[model samples]
Structures are given as structure tokens and as C-alpha cells.
Target: MTPPPPPCLACLLTLLLLAAAAAPPAGAICVPRNPGGHSKPGAPAKPAPPKPKPLTPAAPAPPKLTPMAPGADIVRSLCLKTDYPDLCMSAIAKQPQPQLPVGKRLDGAGVLRLAMGAVRTKAAEAKAAAGALANDPRTQPLARGPLHDCVESFDDIAYSLDQAAKSLAAGDRDTTGTMLDTVRTDVDTCDQGFEEREELTPVMAKHDAELAKLSSNCLAIATAAGLR
Candidate 1:
């Protein structure tokens, strides 16, 4: 048995025990009391909102392409051989392309025929114009004679073009060329007939020039194709 502590020491020991009971534990957090007299724990910090993924743009559509005509290259190659490539191209362009079976296309001879056809049509028109001028009473006497000659010359041109086409079909390239030359001569004769009288008929002259170019194109195309 030990002697009792002094009063001062006992009072000090009681005060230390009371202080320990009132104090918080080692790792405890202190929160301020709310107006309702309750101390609630703080909510966990809200997770940062997920960042929106960057938007991706869509790709643009491809451009539309124009389709090329069949045998266009072949026609262009042939036209390059002519003195009047534009005229040749224009004439051939107007012609309707035959719907050949697949794998087949226009040959040089077929293109030559198209040129010949253009010449034939032009010749017929010139003849009709000359006939019209001859029937017009307002026409001068000298012009009438030349116009009549022109009409005859165009008739011959028509016949020659026909023969040329036939000869081409027969594989007679030399005859075809000869017939083409004859058509050129007939056109020249019409021009000379008017020139002899120092006269000019605008209609006949225009026709003559167009026919000359068409005939020349035919010859060039034939030569290019090894037909002449």
C-alpha cells in the first residue's frame, strides 16, 4: 500500500484525463457545424467532367467526269492529216456513228466515206442555188451564163462523188482518187467561168470554197489511210 497523492497532484491528474477525453483522435478531421447543429463530412470532390471529343469533319464527294465518245481518238488522229482539221472534225461530228458491235470501231475508210458524204451534200446545194439564180429575171446576162455553167459543173461533181464512193467500196483507191480530183476540177471550172466575165456571185463563190475544202479533206484522209 502507498501513501495518498497530495491534493494539488491529484487535481492535476484529473485535469489531464478530462483534457484527453475532450480532444479529437489522432487522424480525425474537424468540420464546422451547420445551422441545424449537425457536422456532416464534406462530399468527395466531383470528378472533373469528361472533356468532349474533338469533332471530325466528313470528306467531300468526288467530282463527276464526262464520258468520252467512242473512236474519238481515231477521228482526231485522222483529222490531223487534213489541211482543214476543224472542218474535218465538224463534218465528221455531224455524221451519225454506226452502232458497231462491241470491240469494233470506225476505220479510216469509214471516216473517208463520211467526208465524201459531206462533199456530196454540199455539191447538191450549190447546184440548186445556181439553178435558182438562173431562173431569177433580175440576174445579168453574163452572170446567167456563168451560173448555168456552175449548175452543170455541180452536176458533174455529184456524179464524180458517187463514182468515187463506189470505187472506194470496190477497193479501187486509184479510181477513187481520180474521181475526187475530177470533183475538184469541176469546182474550179465553176469559179473560172465567173472569173472569165470578171463577175462574182457570192453564193456560188461561197459554195465553191466550201466544196474545195471538203474535197481536199477527203484526199488528205484517203492518203492518210493509205487508200491513195
Candidate 2:
């Protein structure tokens, strides 16, 4: 056309065209083999669920209050049978100027009878307490320890009282005083043990209190009798 292009110029032009077609131009981005490789923006990962707290258990309630019986009645009964009839009677009879003859056999016999009556009353009370404990549901378990102690104490007292009665009948003041001291000690121990337990019912408390009073009275009587 314009004077046919030079052979070398035409070849060079062809090479340039081929190179331009194969290579990417400046400012152009290249695609990866696997397209859409990157994660989308504003798509947040899920948060882990919060850990649970530990549970606590409720506290147990305290023991309930038990009602007490009238202690005065039991006290009066014990005092009348044991303290007033036996100890007080003997103490009064031992006055420097006796109303009745001091050496009278009837006086000694009467004192022995009073002592026997007191011992019998103590034994009866112990048995009755045991029976009541056996029959009562609420007090049965709690009563076992205290009731056992009370009965054992009563047994000791009864034994001592029996010995004392024998001594009194034989006019052995020394032996009688010793026996009374022993009885008083046993009864005191039983009373103290019973008082410590919180499970005592009114009736039980009354019995315990009465027994304690009896113990004190017996101790006084033993001392008055010249034992301790």
C-alpha cells in the first residue's frame, strides 16, 4: 500500500501484538485459581455459650422445742414420801429433848417403815417412767439414754435404801449413813445426766427435777445422820 512495509518492521509488530495479548496490563488485577476464597465482610463468628454456675443446697432447720410438764407436783410427791417422811422425821426425832422415847423400838420401826416407803416410791417412779417412754413415739428414742440412766440410778438407790433399812433395824447408824450417801450420789448423777439432754418432755423434766431434789434431800439426811 504505501510502499510495502519492511519485512523486519512487520515481524517486530507481530511480536509486539502477541506479547500485549498474553500479559496483563498495569492496574489490572489477576484472579486466583479458586475464586471467592476470602470470607465475606461483616459476617461475624458465633460466640461460645456462657458457662453455667454451680447450684447450692438449702440449710437444715434446727430442732423443735419440747413442752415441759409441771415439775412442782412431782417434787411435792417425792419430798413428802422421801424427804419429809423419812429424813425430816428422823432429824426431828433426834432432838436433845425428844417428845417420844428415843430408845423406843416403835420409833425405830416407824423410821424403817418410812425409809422403805421412800425406796418403794423411787422404784415405782422409775418403772412408770420406763413404761411411758416405751409407749410414747416422740420420746422413745430420746428417752432411751436418760431413762436407762434413771432406772439404773433408782436401782442403786433402792439397793442402798434396803441396806440402810437393815442397818437402821439393827441400830447400826454408821452403815445406814454410808448407804444413804451412796444413794444420794447415784441419784445426783442420774439427775445431772438427764438435765443435759434437750429431748426431755415436760413429764420427763418434772421427774428429773424431782429426782434431783430427792438427791439433795438425801445428802442432807445422810449428813444429819452423821455419815458425811
Candidate 3:
């Protein structure tokens, strides 16, 4: 253009033209290929959605029972024959597990076994509860007598129920009935102890209700099994 370029300058210009021809379009951006396929460095980084929290477990449902009858359910079958069918059903169903025996049918003997087991377990629990009350520091010295008596009464009831279970096992229905009845009297005595002092506490009332239910359930079971 201005007197022909020098030889060196001419060679440089030719090289520059060749490089320009090999280049990408002027406005295009170049992105490097990733070897590991990870996300691009500055690409707005699409935020990942947060993970969901785990769900909590549900509580077990209580037993759903119809009116006691001689149909399929063994507990219902036996309880239907008792004086307090509803009470019997509720008490028996409160057990940790109420699975059927070997053949799934509860005969008179089986009824006795189940009832006696329930009675024994409840008697132990009642005795322990009463003992705790007796040992409580919150109770006044004068009011402690009734609670102590209640402890003794529950202990007596426990022993009586154990003996009754043995008599039932020995096939002595009359003796079993006698011991079970004696246990009812002991429960009343426990109540009378608190009543005499006019010191019936909330704890005592709760224990009384639970004890009454368990004892009544045992009595009803005995009646159903023809031990009364």
C-alpha cells in the first residue's frame, strides 16, 4: 500500500491473516469442555431443591371390639357371659398382648388362666403403686397411716389372688371363689382406710379406680368361667 512492505513485515502480515481466518466468530464466547462433567464454574448455579424431612411413626391403635358374643373372638365369647361385659372387655384388652392360646379357643380352663394372669399382674402393680404412696415425702405424717394400710391391703390382695389361681389350677372352684371374694373385701378395706381418715388423695383415687376395675374384671371372669 505505501511502497510494498519489507520482506520480514510481509511475512508477519501473512501469518496474522492466516490466524484470523482460523479464529471463531468475533462475538462468540469460548467455553472449555469439562473432563469430569461437573457443573460450570459461574453459570448462575441452579440451586438444588432442599431434601424433605423424614416422617414420624404412628402410634398403635387400641383394640376395636363389638359387643361381647359367642362368636369368633375368644375374649368376647367369654366376656359376654359375665355380668359386666364392657368392663371385662376393656380390662382384658388393656393387656400388652392378648393373643389366643394354642388352639385359639379359650375354654373354661383357659379363661381361668387368662383371668388369673391378669389379676396377678394388676395386683402386683397396685401393690407397688400403694407402696410408693406410703413412701412419699409429700404425705403428712398423720395421713401416712391410710397409705401404709393400703400398701398392706394390696399385698394381701396379691397373695390372695395368687392362692386363688393355684386353687383354680387344682380344679377347686369353691375355694378359688372364696379367695377371690376375700380379695374384694381387701380392696374395700383399702378404700375404707382412706375414707376413715378423710385423706383420699388424687394418687389414692387413681389407684382405687384402677384396682376396682381390675378386681371387678377378675370377678366377672370368674363368674363367666363358672367358678362363682
**Predicted structure with the largest TM-score when compared to the true one:** 1
Let me know the TM-score candidate 3 reaches against the reference structure.
0.60
RMSD of each: 9.2, 20.5, 12.9
Q: Tell me the spans in candidate 2 whose CA falls farther than 4 Å from its real position.
A: 1-105, 199-203, 212-228
TM-score ranking from best to worst? 1, 3, 2
lDDT of 1 at 198: 59
Clashes of 3: 0
TM-score of 2: 0.45
Question: Among all windows of ten consecutive residues in candidate 3, which has the lowest summed lDDT?
Answer: 65-74
Worst 10 residues of 1 by lDDT: 36-45
lDDT of 3 by residue, 140-217 (tens): 776678777877887888889888978988888898889988887887887887677654554566667766766776
Give the lDDT of residue 204 in candidate 3: 69
Q: Rate the local accuracy (lDDT) of all candidates.
A: 0.87, 0.58, 0.72
Best by lDDT: 1
How far in Å is the alpha carbon of 183 misplaced in model 2? 1.7
Q: What is the per-residue lDDT of model 1 for residues 1-228, given as tens digits with 9 covering 90 to 100?
A: 999999999999999999999999999987665654443556444477999999999888898878768877878899999999999989888877767788988898888988888888888899999999999998887788888999999999889989998999999989999998998899999899877765555458888999999999998999999887
Summarize candidate 2's per-residue lDDT along 14-55 as a digit string, tens digits: 999999999988999865443344544445555779998787
